[model samples]
Target: MRKFSLYMASICLLFGCEETIDVELKDAPPAYVVDAWINDKMETQVIQLSLTQPYFDSSEPTPITGATVTVTSEGKTFSFTESQSGSYTWDPATSTDRIETVGSRYTLTVNVDGNEFMAESELRRVPPVDSIKFTFKEERNAFQPEGYYAEFLATDPVGPGDTYWIKAIKNGIPLNNPFDLNIAYDAGFNEGGNIDGVVFIQPIQDAVTPLNEDLDEIVPYKLGDSLHVEIHSITHEAFTFLQQVQIQTQRDGGFDEIFAEPLENVSSNIMMMNENPDVQVIGFFNVSSVSGRGRKLTE
Candidate 1:
């Protein structure tokens, strides 16, 4: 009996001392992200903005519904209608039928779920093109098996340092794609918002040499030809500040910093085909990615 007792005690000691244990770690908290893109298609008569709902966790984003959205721009106000699948629509009228001043600024206001946001935009005017001429230059590129030269030119009354949208018309049709380039201002202050300059519409992929393709298709401007040009407004400075409202005991980084960045500038222009009146100009431009700190206008 004593030997059996001792054996039992030994078994209990071994088993109890060798007992297994387990533990599990909790996962990290999820993050939040939101993005808004301005629709390029709707520019003149209407401005459409699309908001994206980013994931808060590993799971898919839950739809945002029953939220009121309003936008104000250029002294005009518009509201959004909840469309299918997280889409919204609105059209705000401007103060005048014509586009605002080139340097004049426009403001955009957004409201969602008791939270508000704002963005600013600038309008730039397209400088007039003085003349269209051509020049010859030698080029050495492997892609161009044949030794070629470039010939193309469009002169603006104002020199470089300005942005422009250039287009061409061939055989009574406006070219869908026109080469867009920035002019370099030579020694001028870029003052008064005008520049006289020259630009060459080289053959596809040949910047130095104009490819001998369809002359009507390759050339953007012809001698003594009248062309259409457009320059957009721009804004370099942007900022936002947050306001705090105390609620529960939890002191969440009150009035913390949010998005602090400038938006991308945009411009569009119209080019006329002197020879082809049948062709028309259909173009658009706008700024986007507008984000900043949310400060109550009333506050």
Candidate 2:
């Protein structure tokens, strides 16, 4: 009887009980997504509208059309014309001298199918990039042998709540990876560092380099590679939004399976004026003053 029980136990360990449970996932109604931005430049401002799709659906989100868009600031209103299917443009060349000014607040309003959404942002001043420096170092677990990387030398203005978004362009190609998203809450290396009025720290400086998507590694630049860095003064809300986006992008298979942030919608500045609960909106509206500098890597 003991031998028979042992054999049964072995069998159970090898091929235990199994069952398939059916999960019914109800698809939520589609919501509108708005991508709006206004920079301190003498150019046309653009607003893009689209509808969100299901998670498993592999198609592009449908664009919203026939919407009326307008931007207002300091008692002046500039209307936008639909230039494409889902794109609206406000050309300051035709109506005004410039659309955005430093320290000026702007409000955006969009009316679609009798539903109205509004957002407001201010164009803040960005510190200029004094210079860019590159160095090659050999370190443990490095991707390349004494890989080359660039850093910006710029002093952050003395302020507690100042935020910046740094963008890197390599040979005229913009780096758009989540790993390449570089943002600074203050002059410090990370949040609450309080290293104000000084040069940005090493960790923040190293973020200017691009990353390899396949291996999830930082890619170093080669000699003669042209690098352009643009630093934009962003609102605290915009900084928070980009931080959340970075978290979402970094959470992949293993880490995501073990410890992952709960899936939540990104915060949007746009709001429905009618207080309609049924209508959902996504994305953000941003206004920024940009400062940039470029350099060619050598040695």
Best by lDDT: 2
RMSD of 2: 6.4
Q: What is the C-alpha RMSD of each candidate to the true structure, in Å?
A: 22.1, 6.4
The TM-score values for the models, in the order shown, are 0.35, 0.86
Q: How close is candidate 1 to the true structure, as a TM-score?
A: 0.35
- For model 2, residues 154-179, the per-residue Cα lDDT tens digits are 77887677788888899999988767
Global lDDT of each model? 0.33, 0.81
Model 2 has a clash total of 0
